[model samples]
Target: MNMLYLSVRQGSEKARIWQICDELLARNGVPPSGREVADIYVAEGGNQGTGFTQYSHWKKEYLARQEQAAPREAILLSPGTVTFRSMSVTADGTIMLPADIRRAMLLDEDGRVTVSVVDGELRVISPMVAVRQLQRRTRELVPAGTLVSDELIAERRQEAEAR
Candidate 1:
């Protein structure tokens, strides 16, 4: 997100800047760290350090927003994905991921993912996984709760079983 700078006339300017940054992060996925952007801003623009200070404050707010999502997104794991396995984290913290699995996930440079530790194994997942898992419980994906007839539900369940 572009940092807000040089317009010191308004009282709610800081909040406005932070909301923009929050939307930017959500749209583009989290960066390596918020500080890196601010550091680059100063390096490129030669502005006084106020931008860095503003970013530091916004980073805390952005991170808090991320934290707020954790609980709401929690899900009970499927039998297969919950199985135990061993893994080793690389020195630089990369975990080896299978190409087929990565392809199935459709991961991209700007994509965001969720990681879980299940029985000592690394579980990197797409947000769709949570929605699907919740579907098992609520039988609906959208919060508006579209009604599904029992016959249709049973037919779909049978079809899923056949697969």
Candidate 2:
């Protein structure tokens, strides 16, 4: 048997204390204090300090996770709605992209991207989009019915004859 399972046979003590706290809050609609959990833990032959410490640590981490998940949940609940969020740039000039924006940009695979600034706004273009834009521009510049390959061949023949 795993030594970790032998600790509680169900879950960690932190989970147990959190479940207890949640149940108490649901029943009375009021949050329980550390002292109340410590008292119950002591009565059950567990350490009072352990109960309070576990509850405090679990609550802090759980709240942090919930805060981080809120944005993702909103994106899932409402599709096609724009989500404007502020992100702090790291000291190393790294700006983390959110999951929704990454998915919209089709950046599922790691590849080179062309980053440019136009009108004071940063633009990140994937290779596929960049190539399409280049193709469109080339078509506009080169008029219809102009064979670039034939022109190159004729120029090469003229150069060869002169040589």
Candidate 3:
């Protein structure tokens, strides 16, 4: 029944009780049990029923706040973009991708990554994603209905004839 004689302002007894509960929980990084919180409230000039009810409501809100603040490994970013800063690379040349990036890149199939350096930045790309990017770029650069393979073959034939 460790408690403090806290001065409660007029009409702010509930706030004072909740503040006491927070301070009690924050002390030593280990929360007191429900009975302890209720006992402390009683020691602070509050009745048993109000103390227990206030402590219960305060506990629920505290847990909800903690859950909301917890970090999540998987998160959504803008389309076609996943970014990480200051990620560690092991001495054995292994880099662990975050869960959101892995999910966005569809890395679950074979877990293969194509590593490349572009513009002095390390890039880890999925094989299928890389191929899709290449196809999209080629389509943007080449005209429709143009046979690039046939043109390459014709140039090869002319070079052989000249030789």
Candidate 4:
């Protein structure tokens, strides 16, 4: 919340101009309004300052950085489409999948599953399906009838069994 007063350099009064610009800049894609700008001004602790003067230095700096910004390093959150459902870990540390999802995945109560995190969402897959998927993907990547391919398939099978 570091702030600069435009009036300070001029030895005059408050700094409203930069404050207006900063609020406008901070609004990202939202259409502008006087209320939104005033809200931003108040939210940035503007009311505390003398004569309500000055804009946030961070806001100005943010715009500058955005102008020359590199690609953002950010995580992709899964689309939260799973509705009317919440799960808790059981005493045995296993979550019982919902009836809908279990039916969709064609899973039985006694069936074994491979659980994985993809795009921050929990995924449950059948081990056989997983193995076949791996084999298919491996075949696509590695040429057939290679010693390395055979070894990799064997290793993957072993790992899958161990899980």
Candidate 5:
């Protein structure tokens, strides 16, 4: 999974960002402190200093770090969409993927999938597969929906039951 530090402007500390992060943290059942959440914003290029000059430095450092990190992309989705790609589901049910990859999936704020990226290529997956995978992986830390197709799901299910 990719780790991204998103920075937000000091003035952008509104309810939307907070709501999303809160929901995300709550879904994972790991409450993050304000400082920790602030850290992500700082990493994303947010100004952390009290004054203008210090804030400028923080922004510079954040940008530099982003440049050094792996490239990532985000996909924006309209409201009322559903389903996304599931890269890998862990034993503990934590769905892991690069933050950029998640963004590339273009899931809307409601966690609905509007797009998907597979092997660095963007394509749409069937809604059935998407939903089933999501249902199976809902307990995951960061569910990315389902990527496997119906045939694969059937085969995997059979294999699991056979064991």
Candidate 6:
């Protein structure tokens, strides 16, 4: 998955801050952590040099890399909720989601879903789709004795023959 950092310029409005956070959450399916948010800072004038320049420079560099590395779209999720279907882990321990799932969920290419491992169980961390389509073969191959009545089956056969 992708990691994004948002930095606000000096004198940025509170609404903008909230908006950016909301957008990030919606696009990434998770809220940025305290550390991530804290990393952002405002800059002072060039003459003062009160660490603003350094922070600004770092922000620029980080933004450039982020823009280039990140996907065009970003997925956002609600607070305290994680969506699992949108994320996966690679062999190299990099967190990511499959391309098809990303596309279907409208998540950014670089966006990631959080994952956690505990008690020998691997869990995907997200609020992905709960219902999946059953395979056609599985649906067609209903076990015997599970049917409430054979009338439906007979009707299906008749319809097939008619076609």
lDDT (0 to 1) per candidate: 0.52, 0.62, 0.65, 0.50, 0.46, 0.44
Highest lDDT, which number? 3
- Every model's Cα RMSD, please? 16.8, 22.2, 25.0, 22.6, 19.8, 19.3
Between 2 and 4, whose lDDT is larger?
2
Model 1 stretches astray by more than 4 angstroms = 1-88, 96-98, 106-109, 140-163
lDDT of 5 by residue, 1-163 (tens): 2212244444444333444354545566543434454555567666543223333334334445545664532212211243565576589955544545444443322343345678997554433336556866765743456645765889999999999
For model 1 the local lDDT of residue 138 reads 80
Model 1, position 144: C-alpha lDDT score: 56
Question: Residue 111 in candidate 6 has what lDDT?
Answer: 53
Model 1: number of backbone collisions? 0
TM-score head-to-head 1 vs 6, winner = 1
| Candidate 1: tens digits of C-alpha lDDT, residues 1-163 | 4433223335454544444455556666753233454454456553436544565567555445555656633422222233345667799997765644544564423345798898996667765455556767785543454455765899999999999
Against the hidden true structure, what lDDT does model 1 obtain?
0.52
**Candidate 6 TM-score, true structure as reference:** 0.23
lDDT of 4: 0.50
The digit string of per-residue lDDT tens for model 6 on 1-163 reads 3322244354444334334344555676654432233234232122223233343344334445555767634422212233455556678987554565454643323354555789997755322221122344555677755663587888889999999
**Which should have the higher TM-score, number 2 or number 5?**
2
Model 2 lDDT per residue over 5-26, tens place: 1233356676577666666656
List model 3 lDDT by residue over 40-104, tens digit each: 77887788888767765665566555656665433222125566567888999877777667767
Candidate 1: worst 10 consecutive residues by lDDT? 74-83
Cα lDDT for residue 39, model 3?
81
Best-first order by TM-score: 2, 3, 1, 4, 6, 5
Task: Give one digit per residue, the lDDT tens place, for model 4 in 60-104.
Answer: 344455545544322111111245566798898877676555544
* Model 5 lDDT on a 0 to 1 scale: 0.46
